[model samples]
Target: MNRIGAHLLAGVFRGFGTNAKVIETYEGLDLGKEFTSGKECFPCIVTLGDILLFMKKERERLGNRFNPENYIYFMPESDGPCRFGMYNKYHRIVLDSLPGLDKVKIATLSSEDAYSLSGLIEKEKIQDFRKAAWLSIVTGDILDRLLWRIRPYEREEGMTDRFIDEAMERMTESFSKHSSGKDLSCILNDLVEIVCEAKKIIDPHIPKKPLIGVVGEIYVRTHLKSNQDTIRTLENYGAEAINASIAEWINYTTYDQVR
Candidate 1:
């Protein structure tokens, strides 16, 4: 859920009978270690560990109800000279070793396949999906902004967090109800008010602590396991730590198109 858009995207996919999820794995470094040879790239290592964790947890909780068909991994691919092209293959090799999970589908939506695979979805659903995807991306950005604006200056711990959860729940509900082309501004306005009311900010009269900016590799920056929980540790020490949101990457890519 690093992009945050994926959380909402999962709902869109769910409407099509595909149960998709975006895993923002925690405490997975050790799990990654246990599952991999330590020679894999950090992203691959972390992803493998998280997938393993999901499979294990599902198997435990669902018992016989968990079906591999219901748990597909959506790994989008590109025509690459880059090693990213190999991720799904490596994932398959590792996953085949685990019983019951060997049948879990690793579905790749490659850049090359859009034309050839367009028929996999109905035309009507594709239009609806486009609309849902747009809203998801925008909503994620709003929620992320709300967190940074409120959390650091929150008058009470957890109150801002509570509003965030409620806002997201309502936002998700709104998205689920509308398939396409409904004006989201009405719901969005309500959400903004909810966030503005997260809590009172710290008194501006008092001296403020130093601010820290986290800057580095995108994967390391997004994954707490990869960064050794740097942001949370900073927040715990009474300073505000700001990291660029994943929306920054989306905007950067979009900028590249125009330039």
Candidate 2:
């Protein structure tokens, strides 16, 4: 999953008092593989592992107080040809098999209705939530592009990553504070400032490298471990790379519905 997008989306949920958090990825991969017959796509396995691992840790943290009803496992679905539609059901079966995990609810948004939030949240706040989510996702896409553009030519090694980390924090905070409001101007202003500051990390003296465009399955393309840090690896070999943005997929689903 796109780290920026996931974090910002979680922040948007928090703005509405949902207390959402992004799960740690790739760490629970073995658990995912353990549960599967290796017949599913890599993304499904990895994500399942992430949730399983998170729930395991949460159970340990809470000792006996862990209430499955208190948490919701959010996994969006697609009505498209891909097997993505079956993932939620498959994961439900897996979760139900695990002792005490059966009570943990799974939440989903489908592409069939352009990911309508009708049942997920209160009717009065659905539009506001959707608008905030869109703005957060767009911000994530912009931040990711900024990272790829400057990281390759950063004046100091690790400086770009460090700056981006700080920038993500600031943006997350901004989202939580302004996302509930009708006007998105405050969030846009903050994003602009972060992008402007990101530009300072680039060293103009470095010669440009060959451009490479990465296109593939969304999970493999965005998840670093799944793709083995393909973009960063390309940069290491004297090329700059830009992967497709998550926003593009969201837009496509919307367009598909209209057509």
Candidate 3:
């Protein structure tokens, strides 16, 4: 969401200078509930709502320093029959009428659009983007799983959360250092050590908690904002909430492509 993370993510731009930002906030759902039609899909409503809230917050922060020209919406679309394919057009249509938003640029990577429309982002950059993106997702998914796995069982209520935050920041620092260009083997060793240390602090003989499986839409299930921290809430209520694994989506995507 901030500089180092964005640099690691967008570094795939091959100096094309793009940044990755994620809208993961509970405030977005509040905005979505107000602005979006009730008929819309929950994920769509949250996505649109997050952008709107982000814009408002940024405007407040920037005040006189704000410039619409500096911001660009990175809304990628998939080659699918789902309504998600229209989000880019929907965003454009909606933003066009909003004051001070018409001038803002949108970088859409849809199957039907000019994929290489941005002169700075080209074929080789696309390959870099793909590799960086996969690493990002895999790293993030493991971190999420680790947090979820240990949070419920921690000796102290906030220990797991605090440790995960520190670990993530450390990971960001590693990413910002561009460790991928060098011997990447030692890059995440500290994070692995942190997780191991965390396991040592947890009570080994704590009574087993009841397990609950989470099943639903991919975004809602895995995303904290969309799901309203349901898994954490369940954990607080004395249960182990097992979220769908990242592998599920990967396999599903592969299956979709093949069949």
Clash pairs (backbone) in predicted model 2: none
Model 2 lDDT-worst window of ten? 114-123
Off by over 4 Å in 3: 1-19, 30-35, 110-122, 179-183
Judge candidate 3 at residue 215 and give its lDDT.
Answer: 80
Estimate every model's Cα lDDT from 0 to 1: 0.65, 0.91, 0.64
Model 2 TM-score (2 dp): 0.98
Kindly report the root-mean-square deviation of model 2 from the true structure over all alpha carbons: 0.9
Where model 2 places Cα greater than 4 Å from the true spot, the runs are none
Q: Highest TM-score, which number?
A: 2
Candidate 1 local accuracy as lDDT? Answer: 0.65
Tens digits of per-residue lDDT, candidate 1, 1-259, equal 3444556666556645455566657545567678778777777777777777887888899998988767777765444354555667888887898887789878765544321224434666665675566567667767766665566677777776676777776666566555344565654666667666664544454456678887776566766567877766887787777776655654554454456
TM-score of each: 0.76, 0.98, 0.80
Candidate achieving the largest lDDT: 2
